[model samples]
Target: MAADRGARLGFGLAASVLAADVATKAAIVAWVEYGARHEWLPILNIVHVLNRGAAFSFLHDAGGWQRFFFIAIALAASVFLAILMRRPGSSQPERMAFGLILGGALANMFDRIGRGAVVDWIDFHWGAHHWPAFNVADIGITVGAALIVFHELFGRRRVSEVNG
Candidate 1:
């Protein structure tokens, strides 16, 4: 019963993340002109940009093979996360984290397959220094990773206490 509930929660969250990522990316593509930037706040900007590489545009200039490479990696990661979410004895938080990571990976993979690049629009900047633009999927992945780290460091103790 617990496993079923965990699976439901994890899958539901994954679907939500995927939907938001897709919708936001589509809206940005439809409404914003490519390469155009609009200031939304002192520290934020809305822009239409595509990333051809991994996080921080790593290897963005590495010709074209990186697209397929990244797609492969995303597929493998998504599969692994799905398996983790379904594993017996997994905690709710762990399931949720896996779901987030899976959703983000799948979202980015879809972008790579359909558009040949991932859409990145949210940009934060201060003076001349600017953070790389990213989308909803990146948020899911980043948060999920942090959650997993936090759980590993602190949450395991609580679980041990309850189960021991």
Candidate 2:
């Protein structure tokens, strides 16, 4: 029963996040030309950029094999996350966290396969310093990871109060 609930929660969150991420990417690409920026806030802008590599453009200069490498990694992680989500007795929060990460990973993998690169548009900068521009998919993954960490640090303590 718990497994079923977790599976449903996981799939639902994953699908919703994937849809939002894809839709936003499409809209951004349609409205903004590549490498162009539109400042929406003093510290934020929307810029269309293609990242052909991993985080921070790691391996971006490597011939072309990095694409396949990342694809395989995403594929494996998606499978593992799905398995974890459906594991018997898993909590809803755990499943939801996996869902978000799964959605983001799959979304980026789709970009890697279809566009040959991920489309990123959100940009944040501080005066002379700039942070990597990422998309909604990245947010999903980051937030999901943070939730998992929070569960580990605090959520489990609450659970222990009930079980232990």
Candidate 3:
């Protein structure tokens, strides 16, 4: 990020990701019966399952305290992301990365607050092995994290070298 360029704003992309994530979750909850599983394809499934814990249902079976813990974490992370988004020297990709993270974090936080768990419905599997279910928020977070990593590796290095 050049001094003149400052930080790129990415509220629109973040908002769109949030909207799409919430909309899809709403549709899934409204139409799909809880615990229902549909094999959309040989390798994919559309199911309605509540995840009480983090990725892959870790700590899902814990009594119930994990809920508050996760909420706190997401809330803190969102605040930090907002700060990063406002930094003057942040680049476009960096801003987008933060935006995507913010959207997904808030979306999942909504679920954790409302339902005590996140709604996960996308499942991938082979004959006997099945991947854990995930949703749009998860996708956004995954991609956003990747983007941040990309910027840290190639983007920032190239910029520094060019300037020097």
Candidate 4:
């Protein structure tokens, strides 16, 4: 019963977060253009951009192979996440974290497959210092990763407790 509940909750959170992430990306595409920026604050801006590679724009400059490679990796990661979610004794936090990670990966992968690039827009800067432009899916991945790390570090059930 607990496992079933965890699966439902995890999948629900994944669906909502992924949908919001994708929808926001689509909105950025519709309302913003490449090389354009809308200053929301002195330190924050929304700039339309596309990435053809992985996190932090790794391999972003690759000619064409990056798309295939990234898509393959995202699909594999999503599959592995699904398998983990199905295993008995999966913790709720771990399941939720993995679901978010999988959803974010798949969302970005869909964009790469459909548009040949991942859409990015949110930007932050203070004078000359600037952070990398990112999007909703990236945010999900980062937050999910943090949650996973926290759960592993502090939320795990001890082996003795599990056996008892």
Candidate number with the higher TM-score (1 or 3): 1
What tens digits encode model 4's per-residue C-alpha lDDT throughout 33-126?
A: 8789999999999999999988889999989999999999999998988888777778888888887887788889999999999998889999
- Residue 104 of candidate 3: its Cα lDDT? 89
- lDDT values for all models: 0.94, 0.91, 0.87, 0.86
Worst 10 residues of 3 by lDDT: 1-10
Name the top TM-score candidate.
1
The digit string of per-residue lDDT tens for model 2 on 29-82 reads 888888999889999999999998988888888888999999999999999999
Q: List the residue pairs that clash in candidate 3.
A: none
- In candidate 1, position 88 carries an lDDT of 88
Ranking of all predicted structures according to TM-score, beginning with the best and ending with the worst:
1, 2, 4, 3
Model 4 Cα shift for residue 24 (angstroms): 0.7
Q: Which stretches of candidate 3 lie over 4 Å from their true place?
A: 1-8
lDDT of 3: 0.87
CA error at residue 104 for candidate 4, angstroms:
0.5
> What would the per-residue lDDT of candidate 3 be over residues 1-164, giving only the tens digit for each residue?
45224333455567777898899999999999999999899999999999999888999999899999999999999999878887876788888888888888989999999999999989999998998999998988888999999999899999989999
What's the distance in Å from true for residue 9, model 2? Answer: 1.2
Q: What's model 1's lDDT at 92?
A: 94
- Which ten-residue region of model 2 has the weakest summed lDDT? 54-63
- Better candidate number, 3 or 4, judged by TM-score: 4
Give the C-alpha miss distance for residue 90 in model 4, angstroms. 1.1
TM-score of each: 0.97, 0.96, 0.92, 0.93
Clashing pairs in 2: none
